[model samples]
Target: MDEFERQSEERGWATAKTLAEALPYIQIYDRETVVIKYGGHAMGETAVAKQFAADVVLLKLMGVNPVVVHGGGPQISAMLDKAGVKSNFVDGLRVTDRDTMAVAEMVLSGAVNKEIAHWISVAGKEADVRGIGLSGKDAGLLTVEKTTRTKRDPDSLIEHEVDLGFVGEPTKVDPKLIAGLIASETDDWVPVIAPIGVADDGQTYNVNADTVAGAVAGSLHAKRMLLLTDVKGVMDRNGDIIRQMTLSEAQALIDDGTASGGMIPKLQTAMAAVRAGVEAVVILDGRRPHAMLVELFTEYGAGTLVKA
Candidate 1:
């Protein structure tokens, strides 16, 4: 055979071997629910977004129920800029007022949510699977309460409450809509959720996407909650990724200051999901292609896994 043919043969063999190795891991997650918090570079970059959609479709075809909870921080900011709305952030959460909340809802639920579903539907066409876009407002999927944070005054050395108007925390998550779609036998459906929530007082609130994902995973008793962020994973003091840690170890990281900034919230969300009965939560770098598949189906795995 020619050199080209020989190379092709070798590639085909490698593909077969990889599939063979994935069998057991695939079986482990068959018919199981995995909640993926989709954002960061993966959602921003078009090529990565397409790849992500295809991967979600593959997971569904393999009998893994993948529920995607996506964030649109950058998109919302861009839209706000266009609309001449200035934003303020307090403690990393947007101080969303009435106008800000309207723009947020438009960007997250109206645009970003449908775009993700569109990509997934495009990818799943051949398999007869489709992506259904949803928000917390739809069918009462999520009911939230206003979120408040305390900020320390530099001069007074005291803390004061900061009101993040229209920002919410998930008080109740009703996963029935999601459960029904995934449990349907005749159709394969992947639910793509936007993080906009409604409050008991008939107000709309913008929630943190990671928080929503954790809440959804907990409600569904998901087999895994995959947090796709820009970072590789939770790093130790030595700057190495900690592959696995128990709940106490994770909490210690936060308590001892090993985890800081955005990582702190991610770890806290992971721990909360674990306490809520999620089997495990993995914080993986979404910029790396196929990170979810690697985490789910490979022995080495692709991120820091947190378990109860």
Candidate 2:
């Protein structure tokens, strides 16, 4: 055979080998629920967004129900800037005032949410997947209360409440709508959710996307919750990635000041999900191409998995 023909044959063989290896992993998660928090580079970059959508479509075709919860921090900030509204963040949580909340709602539910769904719907090479864009307010999906943080005063050592207006945490997540969407037999549908919820007082609140994803997964008793961020999973003090850790190990790391900053909230969300009945929660680098697929279908996996 010619060199070109020989190379083609080798490539075909490799493809077959990969499919053979992935079959068992595919079977293991068949018909299982996977909650993915898509953000960071994966959402911002066009190429990465296409890659992520294709992966989500492939998962649905494989019989895995993938629920995507997305964050639009940059988009919100950009819109706020355009509107000449100053934004503030405390302890990595955006302090959403009335104007900021308005901008956030518009960007998250109206723009980012639909854009992600559209990407998934059009990215499928084989069969086009249908994506349903949803907000936490849709069908009472996420009901939240106003969230508060306690800050200790320097020198005085007095604890005081820091009010983050229009910012809330998931108090109750009604998964009925999501369950119905995933249960559709004729149409394979994926839910793309924006983390905009409502409080008891009929006020709209912008919630942290990671926390929303974890809450939804726990509510659904999902098989896995994958948090896709910019970091290389959980790192040790020496700047090495720890492949896996139990809930206790993760907490210990946080207590020892090994995991700080933004990572603390992610780890805390993971811990909450696992404790609430999710089998495992993974914090992985979203910038890596096909990171979700690699973590799910390969033996090596892609990130730090926290489990009970």
Candidate 3:
């Protein structure tokens, strides 16, 4: 029994050692930016939050440039109610007036962005984190137009377009500042971006978290766009994880409706990034402890890997 226990311990240590050995390969892609769209259950849960912070620090220490983009829909909605402002949603997209958009910029760029930066620092990392939180309005970073929806109805038997007012898709992103950040002196500086893009006329548009990250990855031509979601990955009909696939395969799964529900949009964003020449995007479960570090540093990572 003692020998058996000794063997088990040795096996565990061997696995961990092997994972550490793989780190150098990952570092070869270091300073090569990877856009992580952080949100969902991971953001709300305390344990997940702390682990994510540690993960960011670890990534930076490993010489990887991690640009964190966050979502705050739940926070925004709560604030709006507190301010006695009426809110509306169209196809899971919030309808923002000028007032609401102002609140969004303030909250996303000011409060949430800084708070995340602070936490990332407090995680025992002496990072020179320059949290230049901006909406699309600053530096013409993101351009937006209204989101047009195409939905096929079961009863009506027709597909048509519906204009979701103030709901936007990012038409373009100005990557100048992002490039500048990666080129900055500090090896530990990580840019925490809040997902709000601006139009030509200096109007701020509320962009979705995934959309913003995808656009940034596209603009930077990042090696990876790692979306930190709650799920392990895209699951089949029986809810088993799809480990690896090409970008085309992911789209086909969506087309066949095999990947339905909330996973659709997330996978769609990943597909877009790959198509735009981002090397790959992985949808990993952020709820797991050290998932980000494990994914990047080890060959057998958690969740799905969508390659271009």
User: TM-score of each candidate?
Assistant: 0.98, 0.97, 0.87
Candidate 3 error regions (>4 Å):
1-19, 84-86, 124-132, 150-161
- Residue 269 in candidate 3, Cα distance off native in Å: 0.6
Candidate 1 lDDT by residue in tens digits, 191-264? 99999899999999999999999999999999999999999999999999999999999999999999999999
Error of 1 at 151 (Å): 1.3
Winner by TM-score between candidate 2 and candidate 1: 1
Tens-place lDDT per residue, model 2, 18-129, is 8899999999999999999999745777888888899899999888999999999998888888888888888988998888888899999998999999899887644857
Instruction: Please give the distance, in angstroms, between residue 193's alpha carbon in candidate 2 and its true position after superposition.
Output: 0.4
Sort by lDDT, top down from the best: 1, 2, 3
Name the lDDT value of residue 125 in candidate 1: 99
**Cand. 1 Cα-lDDT:** 0.95
Give candidate 2's whole-model lDDT: 0.93
Worst 10 residues of 3 by lDDT: 124-133
- Candidate 1 Cα outliers beyond 4 Å, as residue runs: none
Error of 3 at 30 (Å): 2.3
